[model samples]
Target: MIAALIALCVFALSGFGLSFWLRQKQDSSQPGEAATRGAEQLSQLRWRDFAKLVLQAMQGRGYRPVIEDGMPADGIPTDGSDILLERGGERALLSCKYGTGSIVSAQSLLGLSKSASLRGAENVIVVTPGKFDDEAERIAVPQHIELIDGSELWPEVRPYVARPQEPTPVPPTAASNIPLMAWGGAAVAGILVWFIVQGLQPDSEATSPALAPPAITAAPPASVPPAAATPATTKPVAPPAATFPSDPAVIEQHRRETANAISTLFGVDRALWSTQSTLMVYLSSEQSDPVNELCPLLERYPELASSRVQLQPPQGSTKAVRFKQCRTY
Candidate 1:
């Protein structure tokens, strides 16, 4: 009887201890809660400015690119440098890093690479606006990784994609003065920076915790690294057939815009163009010709034009975008 009682007592004590251990293990594994909290902190950072710079760089290199907010469990996605590239089966998975302290954390890179491996990704690329440290670079490349920094990113971001521009011949009246259309070209140039390769971060609270000393620019050391050729110069583009509907209301709105643009560029009050539906079919002077004419210019897959189309937001969006509505059309 005593043995039976003792056995029961021991079994009860063991069960309690085991339960306690299991609970402890679960508590330890709930590390995701901390990560979630951290992500919340970082969420305030838009990260877009940094992302834009990165995307433009990659696309400029003639590689198909996609942008996404996060990685997927299935590894099937198309967004943010978390991209999938297909170059004759030279497949790769990419994760982009944006404006942050100079240091590149090994934990972040290693985890990303491991994820890629799980997805059977042939390789990985990590692009950062900020620099990565030496240690991060050392660990990354032998593992079949590619690293791109801000300086390297610039030309790619500005890849001379064939785009349409209204080519205005130098009018005999004033050869030296920069054309108003050229100024329009500059506006489009701004779009290229923010458009092609850019990062958007959320507004995170400034914990103002002084960051550690910045990490040395983190990228694979170029030791007999294949030198990338410089991007070539290209001719300006003429407007391609823009994509939009011919909404009279939209067209008339653009007519007003054409007037404003002319005023800004040519210092003329004359609205030289008229719209049919949503399209702004217009007559342009030489000074503003490059921006106004469109039918496929020299740059590759251009998101902007020298003579451009402006698109407006729906009735209640925050701000108005010039020629944005036209792009959608």
Candidate 2:
């Protein structure tokens, strides 16, 4: 009976050990299954959420990121560039495509390249949850578009993809402040020296002898009679009047000279011409408008008095500019 109890005890111990090994194997498999599900869920995220993830990843990579909500009305092509990344004056545009099992196409890359060119971006990137086709890769290679697929989107790759943060600039030390303090000390010393010199000056009244009062003397009793007043003289003289030329050639010359002077004063390149007794000024668009500066010119020149003036911008320019006579004068 004791031998039979020992056999039964050994059998029970062996069964318990087998059960423990099975449980350990099942637990180890659970982690792998969970990891696979997590990766699949990440790949199947919503488009907006995926864009948000891209933004977060870019931020972690030391890039200034902004998400564009809708298409911009500007002249740039709209290729669904949802994210803009900026760093050190360089700009990049990113388009995110999520939850799509198909490969990215070459047409998508072409559109992104065109948008980057129109928007003046230095870099273009397409973020996808799936792989890119062979044609897309060939097109992107030449266009300089970067493609990021789901496999590269893993957490371990983030650190490697992220740019290193720029070192913070060091502030000025106490030694740099020494010059300012020295200047202040020198100013104080100069004031003290001035006061000391003032205090050391000798007093004029203390150093000189005292003067005595002069003796009083009487004047003559008789005085000459007051001189007679002379008669007033009067004269009349005429004032000279200023003259101005009325000749059209002379007036046009004067206008050209005045316009040139005004142009030089205001740092504008302008040409003046006369047509049917009216003055026309052609100004290049590269220079600033001299409309306000023309007021003083009109006031000083009589040749342009009561004459119509026209200001024209460069050819092919759409700038609408109007010139009115100087009413202030």
Candidate 3:
């Protein structure tokens, strides 16, 4: 019984040691697991914040980085490239994916490569917190696209990350010259005002009369002798009569003028005049019949008022319209 109890204690100790050793080995193998988890957490940040971090990281690498403006909430942008980085004449196009679970696919890499070419970038980079698919890596390799995983995005690792340099202050002498510049500007303005006043002043030479006003002379009024009133001769005056033109040219001219007036006033599309003084107006389908508007105009011309006026639609197949006779004064 004593030997069996001692053997059981030894077995328990060996089992505990074996478990601890296995745990340590597993932890050692996954050294990057913590960093991967940290990067994944950052993927939950807002898109703007993520982009800002990216900008800072690129700037820290001695690259002049510009975060391209994103689309407004209401806008949909066509370009997928997000950031531009330049250094020593070398240009790089960067596209970022902040999704935690979204995997970068082969098609996305190819699209980024195409965008880089269009933008004249020598290098293309795809930054993502999420892992890429095997096909994505394969395609990116041939296209020379560099993939930046979340593990590589720690901003603290970049030595050059800093704010942009502030502008230099102006010298005291240069600042003092501001008042002198103001005074000089005032003097120039005063000179301009003086010139304007001089120009506006009336010229006495131009206003001067070429000759003196003619002297008024008065002559004695001539006396007239009174004449006896004689009986007025009576002459009969005939009333003026309205005369129609006998010439066909004059009649045609009148017809054209009447047609033009109807077209302009009533928005008629076309007007035709017959030799019998009849007027046919083609009404645009878009406009209502303008007979009420035409009545007042027709009253002014006795001859036109007496002549037959027909309103027809654009298509002759439609019915025609005739207005009642307008009262002539």
Candidate 4:
């Protein structure tokens, strides 16, 4: 029994440790993904701002803004949208396309290269949060035009984008470890029972009923006289009344608190709120396991445990939202 209990404890501790470790690792990587998630926000910027971002990225590569006659000092054109960058006395024309929906075509690159050559630029650079076509890539090679697609553009502007700050994940509480611990304890108990049964078998086989010693008996002493009986009166007790909040304001507050608590628990940075008793949480499409970790923790707030949870997919995603609720009846 002792050995089994010890083994069960070890198993439970190991499982709990592994769960906490994994959560911490996931928390650590969230900061890196912060910029990627910020991509949605980045795509929403105005064209002018996007052009300025491209300018900054080019400047980081040792390019300086070449202010021309009747052009903005930032090298951004007031009449047109193209930017001009100069490095080592060589000029490059830059075009910034922000949306990720469309692809850059070969015809567009041909025109851009011709415009750059007319403007006395040595090279042309097209930066977009979208991909370029095969023909565009082929033309770009001969024209000395640099194509910066979504894959390359994100890294270039990641430093300039605003990333959400996620809170540090705290160690998993004992309550979170209950389910796994219960399973571990059950396994240990079963093994201990089997051991106990096996040990009893040998003892039972060696002992015989015929060789057992006779039982002994003892006489009772004289009884003393009973004291005078006393009577006492008691009043009936009533059970405590159950209190459930019915006010709209109070319920809404509880709902918000519950959502915030859950978000903090998982280190999610997005706003979490409840609608019609269903808590909504937003997460990246790649993250689905956190939903599993969420359901069990709902028990921490008994008043709000009845509310169902819905996970909203990341912005501009087509994936369906996931809904879950933990019930204790």
Using lDDT, give the best candidate's number.
4
TM-scores for all predictions: 0.30, 0.34, 0.36, 0.40
Could you give the candidate ranking by TM-score, starting with the highest?
A: 4, 3, 2, 1
Best by TM-score: 4
Per-residue lDDT tens digits for candidate 4, residues 1-329, read 55566656666666566567655765667655654444455567777777777778888899998787888667777654677778999998887765435587755654565467667788888987667887567546644678887657766776766663333444578446655655565566656665765565545534678766676777796675455244455888899744657887986775664454345333233436556657777774445445544554455456666667777777887788777777643
lDDT tens digits, residue span 207-315, model 1: 3347445558889865663455556679999888656435657645544543433332221213333333232422223223323222221111222223344332334
lDDT of 1 at 180: 39
Give me candidate 2's TM-score against the actual structure.
0.34
Which candidate model has the greater TM-score, 1 or 4?
4
lDDT of 3: 0.59
Please give, for residues 213-314, the per-residue lDDT of candidate 2 as tens digits.
Answer: 455788877764555345556786778543557787887666665555444322244546566445566765636566666655555555465556677677
- Candidate 4: which stretches are off by over 4 Å? 1-35, 99-101, 162-329
List per-candidate RMSD values in Å. 35.5, 31.8, 38.4, 22.5
**Local distance difference test, each candidate:** 0.46, 0.58, 0.59, 0.65
Model 2: residues >4 Å from true position, as ranges? 1-39, 66-81, 156-329
Which runs in model 1 stand beyond 4 Å of their true positions? 1-46, 66-81, 159-329
What is residue 50's positional error in candidate 3, in angstroms?
0.9
- Tell me the deviation in Å of residue 143 in model 3: 0.6
